[model samples]
Target chain A: MERKNFLRTFALVAATGPMIIDGCKKDSATKSTTSTTGTTTSTTTSASSGCVVTPTETEGPYPYVGGEATNPLNRVDVTDGQTGVPLSITFLVVNTNDNCNVVSDARVDIWHCNKDGYYSGYANQPGLLGSKSYVGETWLRGYELSDSNGAAKFTTIYPGWYGGRATHIHIEVYVNSVMKKTSQVTFLETISDVVHVSTLYAAHGVNPVRNASDSVFGDSATDLANEIMTLVGSVSAGYAGTYTIGLAL
Target chain B: MYKAKIKLVYKQVIDASSETSFEKAIIHASYQEFLLKSQAYNAEGKFKTFSRMKANDGRANSLHYKLSFSVLHFIEQLDNKIPVIKDNLGNKLSFDTAAFELIESHIEDSSLHKVAINYQTETLTLIDFMGDYLLLTSADAKSNEPSETFVVKMQPGLSIMNYQEINQFAINNLQLETP
Candidate 1:
């Protein structure tokens, strides 16, 4: 009976050991953020090869704040029935502090302007769409948790360009409920050039500011390379874009 | 005037039922509370201090309190002056600033009342100013103890693109402008 009891105890420990370790890991990650200095860059000290800390950019005036309390939509397709060219945007999040390993279960949020360059959940978006209030509308804004592979994808339309900015998408990476990075990724000029002239986007015309002239992206080559996404598709069949974000979490 | 409010609370299970392992006595104490100040300044060019209040439910197991000023006042404190730089080659480079940070002690004695007994912290945040609001990862550390700081990001009622826009919008919202 003693042996049986010992075996039962051993089984319980084996079953809960991993879960306890995970809880500790999450707790440590949380502690690091509170003690972190002002920089929004990665707080960890490890330098993994090929992992560049994604440049921190402004979430602008239109990121969906308030998390679950706001929209409460955990979806993969942020199109929200808006008509435009279909695009599959993929992000691979790796931890520079963890040997560039994929960060599974990280929350990734993607938001951008519709084809006419109007963002949802705002009343002051000025563009071809005029001054429209999408105040209650949550189109083109949603979040998905990364899978075991540290990747999240969104089925979004080709984003439209707004004044004072190039065609780009805003992304936020949250690991263990802490926002590690808030950045924007721009499409290659070659890709934006084609999508802007397509049927739905034609009304807005091509974006005047290219990647090299963008306020956030044009600053340096490293910025552009870190934030630029690669697209492989056409306006007719839609495009698939991929970007890897490195965080010093 | 407080424009934005952010609160982070940490809970601890002080006592639990041994039979059921159910939490019986729990402490839901606030780790931090940040209130953004709106007044221009006082006689000493200082902002009003954050109001502190504590409350307890019928259980009497938790402590709730408010402390610290909002990090947004950093915008009003800005001189709004753009610095011009000239390189050795006699070329002028225009500088445009977009973001600002207010670094301060994340843990105060009042904030540690029930959450910690003896706390020693060296961590801080360069709180990022996002136009009309502020975004930061709230953190604190305790020597030789397991500590956790929840991520806290906030947006005021209005959000804008740049500092100019934030200034104009804040002024209008606060009615600081004179006719």
Candidate 2:
């Protein structure tokens, strides 16, 4: 009887060992983004405590890197003298696998579209809004460094939605000038649907996409709720929101 | 995003059976969600920061990759294998170095991946990126003969492509480093 019991135990271990090993291999792919700092490459890394690196995303074509108004790393205000409702964004950078510790001194870059769904510096580009171009135009893109406590802030307008995608802002995190992660952050659709859409955003048309429907958001559905910014102000005076983004370095 | 699957044929040894378990290995690739390529990204910039976005159903190469990974990720294809490269300059580097120069430097969307790899040499002879997830096995690794060929099977969303169009489209966009 003892020998039979031992054989049964052995069978269970043998049956489950390979699966356990296989599960270890995929842990990184599901937990972290570990690719090089390419424009759209995603490798994998492991994270235990902090949030996994935001999934890497395409660096959309219009990352205008022209001049000062375009580079807003030092100051809190990033409006660049453009016309739109007032909005402010903040980012908190942290390291992963280390109890979500704040990663100080890292550089963060942010860029988004103006209220009309057009990006700056691309002239006469056709869009849902018609064929007007901001060629040589530079607004709504810049870089900033995380403070000693891992905080970076930008003053700008709420991003307007285009036809194909939900509202989003792109960001890149860097340590020692090495690109560590690239991802898009989004607002609650209710905020865009009722506030930004109803007020200054009305003429462009309603933001028809929702979180469940957007592909990018759907791809990372489990993390979407955590990545969204929490807001406080009204559309009349302009909305303000704060976000805590944990980056696994 | 559309739904699709890719297949990979491999050779696996069945120790308990004492024979080839199957003539070839079987694998499939599937995604939980896919994003259609965005139209807002087509405008030309003085300097390009990202690549073109093709709708999820339209990216042929990425589809091929999903199929490839469904197989390669499960098999023992690259362990301790060395691929041969004969360069005029006679340069030798570690696999990490070679992988960095060859795939890491050229492709964007750098994410540090967790993969099980064990190699004897520093040479990145085992793997290289063709397009997205489609990994190219070094032609020299399988003795003098090339390994089994990989093919991408089109699903419901893709229309058939002519020979010329296949040659015209890039497998993956390579970022040219500026001085």
lDDT of 2: 0.48
- Global CA lDDT of candidate 1, please? 0.53
The stretch of ten residues in a row with the least summed lDDT in candidate 1 chain A is A61-70
Best by lDDT: 1
**Residue A143's C-alpha lDDT in candidate 1?**
80
Off by over 4 Å in 1: A1-71, B1-179
TM-score of every model versus the real structure = 0.45, 0.42
User: Would candidate 2 be rated incorrect, acceptable, medium or high by CAPRI criteria?
Assistant: incorrect
Q: What lDDT tens digits, residue by residue, belong to model 1 across residues A17-99?
A: 66754444432232112243556643432123323222324433211222122223467898988989999988999999999
lDDT of 2 by residue, B1-179 (tens): 10112212211211122222111121101110011111122222221112223332234333222222222212222221222221223332112100100111001222211111121222112232244333222232323344542222222222212111111122222112211
Q: RMSD in angstroms, all models?
A: 24.9, 23.5
Pairs of residues at least 3 apart in sequence or in different chains that clash in candidate 1: A34-B139, A34-B140, A38-B126, A42-A248, B35-B70
Tens-digit lDDT string for candidate 2 (A67-155): 22322223566577776777877788888767888888777767778888877645466666798755323478666789998888888
In candidate 2, which residue ranges exceed 4 Å CA deviation?
A1-75, B1-179
TM-score of 2: 0.42
